[model samples]
Target: MTKLKTDRREVPVDEPLDAEVVSFRAAFDQRSPIDQIVREGARRMLQSAIDAEVDDFIARHAHRTDEQGRRLVVRNGHLPEREILTGAGRIPVTQGRVRDNDPDHSRRVTFAPTLRDAGRYRT
Candidate 1:
């Protein structure tokens, strides 16, 4: 026979509970079909808005061109996908990446979505 080691700790009333001991109420699998549908819709809408923002940025910089007469500020590709926590749930989104091909690094301009700057959506 082997001896068993059992350790116990005392908790204070003012102390907060550990994360492992707390249960989440908005678990993904536990959510209803309607909730899932709403989340999908929200994700699509958010993506569309971001795309529009990118388009607007490119339009505003249309005058900026290189020696070859090609637009300097244009969409290169998309950034890595990330999940943003929203009111509906965790929504996956990808932001458009803009490249400024200006030879002068000091005059280069970058694009940033307004939504990302807002504190409401925390990734």
Candidate 2:
């Protein structure tokens, strides 16, 4: 590789060169590896906990069926995708959905997971 020579009038030797000029972000962009690992761990843990909560909630009414042999609780699909901001970082998650089969068609229920103020899930 060849280095280009700069004109003396354009850039004085007393002043800093172009290569020496570093922006604040570029100079301080080094991230901590341990912090990244910890944040990833936290994200996975939160996701797992939410999944377990949904599973437990479904298990409560999954087995029983009505007189017509329709399961009491059935998995529909997923709710909506949303992200939650945490101390670690922003975590993305999609909660599971369930339909509660009732004898009366008008009284059927659908489970909607909500994030409580305590940083826990409420089904």
Per-residue lDDT over 1-123 for candidate 1, one digit per residue giving the tens place of the 0 to 100 score: 999988978789999877655655336348788988998999999889889999999999999998889999999999888777788877888889999999999999989789776425444
Alpha-carbon error at 74 in model 1, in Å?
Answer: 0.9
The residue ranges of model 2 lying beyond 4 angstroms of the native Cα positions read 1-22, 26-31, 68-70, 114-123
Candidate 1 backbone overlaps, count: 0
Q: Candidate 1: list runs displaced more than 4 Å.
A: 1-28, 119-123
Q: Write the per-residue lDDT of candidate 2 for residues 1-123, one digit (tens) a residue.
A: 999987765666687656645565576565589877877887778778778777877787666688877778877787776666777656666767777867787767566555534454323
Question: How far off is residue 23 in model 2, in Å?
Answer: 3.5
Q: State the weakest 10-residue window (summed lDDT) of model 1.
A: 20-29
TM-score of 1: 0.72
Q: Give the Å error, residue 37, model 2.
A: 1.4
Say which candidate scores most in TM-score.
Answer: 1
